[model samples]
Target: MRVLITGVAGFIGMHLALQLLQRGDEVVGIDNFNDYYDVRLKESRLQRVVDADTAGKFTFIRLDLADRAGMAKLFAEEGLDAVVNLAAQAGVRYSIENPLAYIDSNLVGFGHILEGCRHNGVKHLVYASSSSVYGANESMPFSVHDNVDHPLSLYAASKKANELMAHTYSHLYNLPTTGLRFFTVYGPWSRPDMAMFKFTQAILAGQPIDVFNYGKHRRDFTYIDDIVEGVIRTLDHTARPNPEWSGMKPDPGTSKAPWRVYNIGNQNPVELMDYIRAIEEALGKKAELNLLPLQPGDVPDTYADVDALVQDVDYRPSMSVDEGTRRFVQWYREYYKV
Candidate 1:
């Protein structure tokens, strides 16, 4: 399969690209390499992808997703079999600070991806949505079928809009589209802005860690490998119309068209303090805590019900927070020579 992955320099994108390459798939990846976090980390991830391409089956292009002409040209020329759209302006708090960034990358850029897939005859389009889309809904285990019409942040709103836009394309063009609503993803090479990364950095630097929601918030912390596996499985299984779908009783997760959404998560929710304890145990250091209230646009908990993913893909996430945190700390120590 010839796959194009946008945001190849991103945390999940880089991991997914390497996995595909290992399986002998031709991968064409593009990333604008913006300064959302650290450009050097992005560069290093890209370099790793380049180095791992022993079969010379991987290609990297420095392009932004919002660039209409560039995205169209690439899609037209590459003859891509599938596309995994991972590029977006992530972070709920960041969206509040810079809402325009989300508009350009998540909204406008996603439009370009949909257009590219629509015109180029791409068989499958798997894009990243967020568990945050379950905004304001007090559901215990957030399901794909749940209503996600109320988004707290622009980031979540953009992701929801992407799902709607993808459904439109799928209905009109018969394009297969799958949106994976990812939970809290954490592992080696994670974005510096994420809680796990920030907590680790601060703890290692002997600084105090800000405990959000007074360490009461819970999240379904999923490992990186599990996410990549779910993505590959979904990519292999093209979206199909739900025969049972009806207009009178609509399912937000599935449509009459070739469109679907699934929650790719561990299905295990961990308390914020418990997660911090895992990190502390991994590093063999106690963290100085600055307990604080939850920030704006942040949810108190996120627990994904991945029943559809398990039933469809025959896969389940097995990594525990303890083991995942240990691996990440090991990677951080090695990478930083600490």
Candidate 2:
């Protein structure tokens, strides 16, 4: 399959692109390489993806999702078979300061992606959603079937908006769209802003790590490899109208149109202190902790109910924080020569 993967230079995108390329799929990757984190890290990831595939099955394009003309032209010319839209303005805290960034990238950019997929006759459109969308709902485990009308942050709101937009396209154009509501994704080459990356960097540097919610938070931290596998499986499993869906009692997870949403997570939610302990064990270094209140726009816990995903795709994330942290520590040491 020939696929177009947006944000291909990003942490998850880079890993997903490599897997797709290794599986013999012709891949066209695009990213604006914004300085949301480190552009150098993004460049290195892109280079690694290129270096890994000597077969010339991968192509990288420097394009932003917000570039309407460029996106239109690329979709028109590329003859893309499938699309994996991972490009977005991420970070819940960052969204509070830069609300417009979320509007431009997550909302406007997603609109463009929907248009591209609709017009290009793409077989399937798999896009990134977020677990944060389950805002204000204190359910033990977040389920796709539950209502997600209240999003605490602009980032979460934008993600929820994406789901609605995708449904419109699916209803009007018969475009098959699947939205993967990703949990706390972490692993090697992880974004520097994420907790795993920040904790690792601080621990090695002997700096105090900020323990949010006084280390009371819990997260379903899915490893990158597991996420990539779920993505591939979901992308292959094109969205179809749920015959069981009823307008009388509409299921938020599915639609009468060819649209669906599934949570891609580790199912097992680990406490923040436990995750930090795992990192400490991995690096063989103790972290000086600064226990802090939960920042605005942050949730106390995120537990994903991925039964729908497992039923449809026969896949589940199983990597434990201990093992994942160990792998990340190894990569960080080698990459930074620490």
Candidate 3:
């Protein structure tokens, strides 16, 4: 399969690209290498992907998703068999600072992706969504069938908006669009901005770590391999119109159109402090904790009900936090030459 994976320089995208390449799939990936956190880190990830090309199986483009004309040209040229969109301006706190970035990337960029997929005769479009969409909903183990209308943060709103837009395209053009709402994902090559990475770095450096929600938060921290596995399986299964969908009692999750949403998560929520402790234990150090209130747009907890994903794809994100953190810290130390 000729797969176009956007954000191939990202943590998850790079991993997925490696798996796709290892499986003998021809892959074309795009990433603007935005300095959202560290462009160097992104470049390092890109390097790994480029280096792993034993058969010259992967090609890359330094393109921004917001550039419609640029993306349209690539789309017309590639004749893509499938699209996996992982690019976006991600970060809830950062969204509060620059909301326009979210609009540009998550909203405008996603629109371009949909357009490209539609015009290119793509078979299936598998895009990244977030568990943040289940904002303000005090529900345990959020299910795909649940309503995600009330997103607390701009980032969450953008993700929810993507699902809606994808459904519109699916309904209009019969595009098979599947939105995967990933929970707290962490592992090797993890983004430095994420909690697990930050905690590990801080603990090792003897820096104070900010414990959000006064360490009362819980998250279903999933490992990267499990995430990639779920993605690969979903890529094989194109979206299908829900036979049980009714306009009279319409479901926000499933559609009369060829649209579906699934939560890709561990299905096991762990406390925030425990997650920090996992990292601490991995590094054999204790973090200087500065317990703080949960910031605005930050949910107190996230638990994903992946039964629908398991039923559809027969996959689950089951890596324990301790084991996952161990892998992450090992990678961090080696990657940083610490």
Candidate 1 lDDT over 18-79, as tens digits, reads 99999999999999999988999999999999999999999889999999999999999999
lDDT, model 3: 0.92
Query: Which scores better on lDDT, 1 or 2?
Result: 1
**Residue ranges of candidate 3 with Cα displaced over 4 Å:** none
TM-score of 2: 0.99
Give the whole-model CA lDDT for all candidates, comma-separated: 0.95, 0.94, 0.92
Candidate 1 segments whose C-alpha is farther than 4 A from its true place? none
What are the TM-scores, per candidate, against the unseen true structure?
A: 0.99, 0.99, 0.99
Error of 2 at 237 (Å): 0.5
Question: What is residue 178's positional error in candidate 2, in angstroms?
Answer: 0.3
Report the lDDT of model 2 for residue 337. Answer: 98
